[model samples]
Target: MGESDPFIQRVQDVMNAPPLMVEEKESIQHTAEKMVDQQASSIVVVNEKQRLHGIITEKDLVQRVIAADKKTGTAADIMSASPYTISRRAYYYEAMSSFLMNGIKHLPVVNEDSTSQVVGMITLSDLLKKQNRGKFDVLREIEASSSESLADVKFAIYEVLGHLIDDGIPILHIMKVVTNLYDRLIRHCTELALEEVKEEIGSPPCDFAFFLMGSGGRHEQFMMTDQDHFLVYEEPAKEEDRQTNDAYFKKLGEQIVYWLETAGYKRCDGNMMASAPGWRGTIDHWEDRIRTWGLRATNENILLGQNFLAFRWIYGSEKVRDQFVRGVSRQLGKSKIFLRRAAELEKNVPVPVLDHPIRALFRVKKEGMDIKKQALFPFHHSLQILSAEHGILGETPEEMIEHLKEKRVLDEPFADELLYAYEVVLHIRVTQSWDRYKLEEENSSEVSFRQMKSRDKEALIQALKAIRSLQTKAVATFGMA
Candidate 1:
């Protein structure tokens, strides 16, 4: 690869080496003089042992020293402590993502071996100058998007997805990167909605957390994502205070849904959005609902409970989110009957397309099979129940599978087979989804048997068979057989 190839270039190739460094006790005036003398925008502040302690940027000098008139302050007092740093050997795209996701301009580079040792630094300007701006324009657009401009950012996201796929990046890696972009977009929408809500009503009554569900929750979204989110707020002490908090969160949830729709995300067809009464509630209410779902374990309740099991906190108070999660886990731990029922329900699900021989392609028909429902759902449902039983929580199926293996629930060979099968199915689903998205199709998970390459079709069939075997194993393990 040439020097201009951005994909293959490492961070060391672009960073400023022998970065200007100053001791933590150095005066602010001296740090400023070093920055000016070096003609650098930022300087790394190190301890006496020459380990990274903090970073002092020109902005720090201007705002912390000159504007505040703290002329006698040392570098340690003015610098940003424990600033984000990148490995010298990381790919350039990783550095770009760090810059885009964190909204930071200057990223300190540390030695790959001893992470605390400062090695170099890379600025956002350096990235823009070194790589093609068109590739990163979507990230910049997302950062700068308004309510009206977010729709355009959605399209730019598709472009980036296509580029990543063409560049031969692993499907899971691409999903993570794309998920980060979507998370940022959701956060932006949430901020906008909060501003509107605060202006309409006073500030929030208490701390709250907004979390995602379904694909967004699992960090598995690739294209055509819908709103599957909920809100949990701190319980109030008095009746009147509770009423006020309810009203405040109700309006906030409605505004969040509205802004997300404006940004091109569709509303949940199952009414799983935060705007719904069942979805948004006080922490106590959520706990009650979880207990109720476990006790009842009706078909509808089980479906809802299963979806809730994958909840991932995206915004707000971590303490509140942790409280909710821990409560649910405790409830699930005692609900052995509910977990068995969930496994039993999944046992009845059949991989219809895989039930017949590949030569009997007529079974798939011209319309194609819904790969997500027929292939992926069984794997997800089985693993979800198993994980919940073991008190393991993860954001993705791969993570859950790894956790299961760690707990000795799955042997090494079986876990490896399941992981490979999952990857094959997921890769096809994502790529086909992108193809359908480009054609403006509504359904993203359907795969036409006729259009699939012979090898992919065979691999998918094998994957589905493996999923079926797992489903059977789940039933036997749960004593449902």
Candidate 2:
């Protein structure tokens, strides 16, 4: 049905009234009580013409009033003047995203002339009604695992995207949500590792660091992303010499990886795990690896090594993550060779494009789309190459876009537009994979974006095209890629 359907129309009619507007000069105590009595979380602050000026919520009442030891006068002082808002023509689905993401209870709907006459308020609960859920096999395993497997976590992660897709969640917000979950999973895994293995390290709490790279780095990881990761450490001066520190870091790697695999992330196909002495390095050792990996860029072995680029501190000391990030920055300044190699590797992975004459758009069937080999990976590699060149280590495509744009590689409008495309592809991939897996039509190793609906297929293909264009622009600017 169109957005004007009876269901939406009724919801709008009832929800259309602006919160009981109290003028900006209204007393805090009076407004707070009015809000409570009206069963509202917030009230609009408006000028006499009813145009939106600001807002105050329950949070303001507590944080500004009670916690700060302020009386009724202070609550309104804490109100937000710059809240996110939407226009009247916006679809209910559009508000769904703003509600959950912007963390607002009410969106002051304004008219064309910019009068915030309190046309509507969209509650989080209002949008939750549209959410759809799909059963995931991995959730059962995640709960059951004694040591959370990265593999199970990966699948569980997949289900999150599936949930968003089935519920018709906006694609852009879904990307953010999924990336946030990926980040959270690694963090939780790190916490689990820290708790399980800290005594072995024996220093104070702040001695180690975790690195999540590749798909995890780009924040665009899909359901089937393999664990391509590494671990690095610093010399624990408190523990005396290098050997003791080395042993401690080594054991930490074994423990973390054991749990990761047992939990579900398959060991890296290249075996570049922290368990590998080559990958589990002290600061000097890591410096050597980065330099060598860059210098020896042509070797197939090191070419495969770029997958390790998805580094983030999942556990250990913030100092370690910070130090390593700094080292990366300095080291990356010299990595033109490595960035070039990454671009060469991308050529091996052909992006599926539309059979359309323009070739500007990807032509995809409603069958199996190689969202990975074609659209996802090429864009990922190009972005990675660009990110490394600029010494920016963004954990996801969305992050990369921001950093890239800030550095002048991509303009703001295009960055946003391309990210939107990338999200649509992810949403489709997760939904299709979930349904196929549900029916036992397929399992591991075969899920892809080919199963998307036609309209979705067109959009996804179009998105791939946009990413490809952005990547091309990035390559030209960076020159080496």
lDDT of each: 0.83, 0.63
In terms of lDDT, the best-performing candidate is 1
> What is the TM-score of each predicted model, taking all chains together?
0.87, 0.64
Maximum-TM-score candidate? 1
For residues 54-106, write the lDDT of model 2, one tens digit per residue.
Answer: 88878878888889887756334777986777766554544554554455677
- Cα lDDT for residue 111, candidate 2: 54
Cα-lDDT of candidate 1 = 0.83
Residue-pair clashes per candidate: 0, 31
The runs of at least 3 residues in candidate 1 whose Cα sits more than 4 Å from the true structure, single-residue gaps closed, are 1-20, 27-40, 48-52, 58-73, 82-104, 109-120, 352-368, 442-444
True-structure lDDT of candidate 2:
0.63
